[model samples]
Target chain A: GAGVSQSPSNKVTEKGKDVELRCDPISGHTALYWYRQSLGQGLEFLIYFQGNSAPDKSGLPSDRFSAERTGGSVSTLTIQRTQQEDSAVYLCASSFSSHSEEQYFGPGTRLTVT
Target chain B: AQTVTQSQPEMSVQEAETVTLSCTYDTSENNYYLFWYKQPPSRQMILVIRQEAYKQQNATENRFSVNFQKAAKSFSLKISDSQLGDTAMYFCAFMKHNTNDMRFGAGTRLTVKP
Candidate 1:
């Protein structure tokens, strides 16, 4: 694809429900990342995956937040028992390779936990 | 631990004028990367510019340039000949040279008034 793509551009779910956000990175991108952004707030790093392996999961806010990348091309972020605090825009980005290069971002998925 | 900071919460610039957005970061690692990303109303994060810590010369792209002072840990973006299209939230980000974790600072909202 031309750039990173994300599914379910907007999602509204009841509190406590589980939601999954998907990201399809560029054709050859090997580094995938997830981030959360609140209204008028800065982006918070969630997790990073490199080549189907996540070497750093330290940014996951809680046990309910988890992510996995398969084939080093596609990734998914799952939020279990979503809370109102989880209502925000979830972003996905991928770079050609990790090595401090530029990252192309997706049209983030806006998740609203009602 | 690496942390990025953008102290200016908001800034306004007139068309054709110039404005500088301030950013500072703290890190124990000497080799890393710094970046500036812009997010408009459309909600897509776009890379503005990047700088390698080892590079002494500042990075520049058209009207956008960075003043990077490694000793003072300051990386500021100077937007010369500003345009209304430049109005958006600008973020400062840091990434370790060998790691996948890209830490971002609280963004500075830049409004380029016509």
Candidate 2:
């Protein structure tokens, strides 16, 4: 079975430019989440989507950060007007459902805002 | 709000020896799940082990196991006969029973040397 996968493993962009990171969750996974890992820091919750229910957006650090899951399988995290502080590893994870304890994670996309 | 803590920033263990990584979390929810995830230099987050808060017995997977203290809010991971491949950044995570929101602690960097 295929595990979660992400595209553009490394991305370098200008500070003010917008970047979109993609995630392909494991087939049959209905719960998807996005998290940020900064240097010397823990993973910070970003956003989550469960099936077709409304996504949890509370974890978004600011209005510039947003994410969307399309057709309940693929997700994209878009950062608008990125800042140097946004330079970090973007990790995506998915679970069988919201109640599933073990979530499968993908190889993260490292974004560097230059 | 839930929070996970890993006090040890780094640890080293000799190959074939045993090592323990401590983790503590603060949460009001009575039922939840605790997880240990390993992230190597490849940036892929892998689930090492998991424990259900409602279960009294600890969970074990091969040489990896957990010491889950539900009352004390502590969940420690123990690795026996540690191998060089076990060297990685280990993170402790918390997730309430029925939600997609999960929290992670600042990781502990483990080095297994021969």
Task: Tell me the tens digit of each residue's lDDT in model 2 across B35-54.
Answer: 99999999899999989898
Clashing pairs in 1: none
Model 1 residue runs over 4 Å out of place are none
lDDT of 1 by residue, B1-114 (tens): 899999999999999999999999999899999999999988899999999999999999999999999999999999999999999999999999987778899899999998
Residue A33 Cα positional deviation in candidate 2, in Å, after optimal superposition: 0.5
Error of 1 at B45 (Å): 0.7
True contacts kept of each: 0.89, 0.83
TM per candidate: 0.96, 0.97
Docking class of 2: high
Q: DockQ numbers for every candidate?
A: 0.82, 0.82
Per-residue lDDT tens digits for candidate 1, residues A1-114, read: 899999999999999999999999999988888999999998998888888554578889999999888777789999999999999999999988887889899999999999
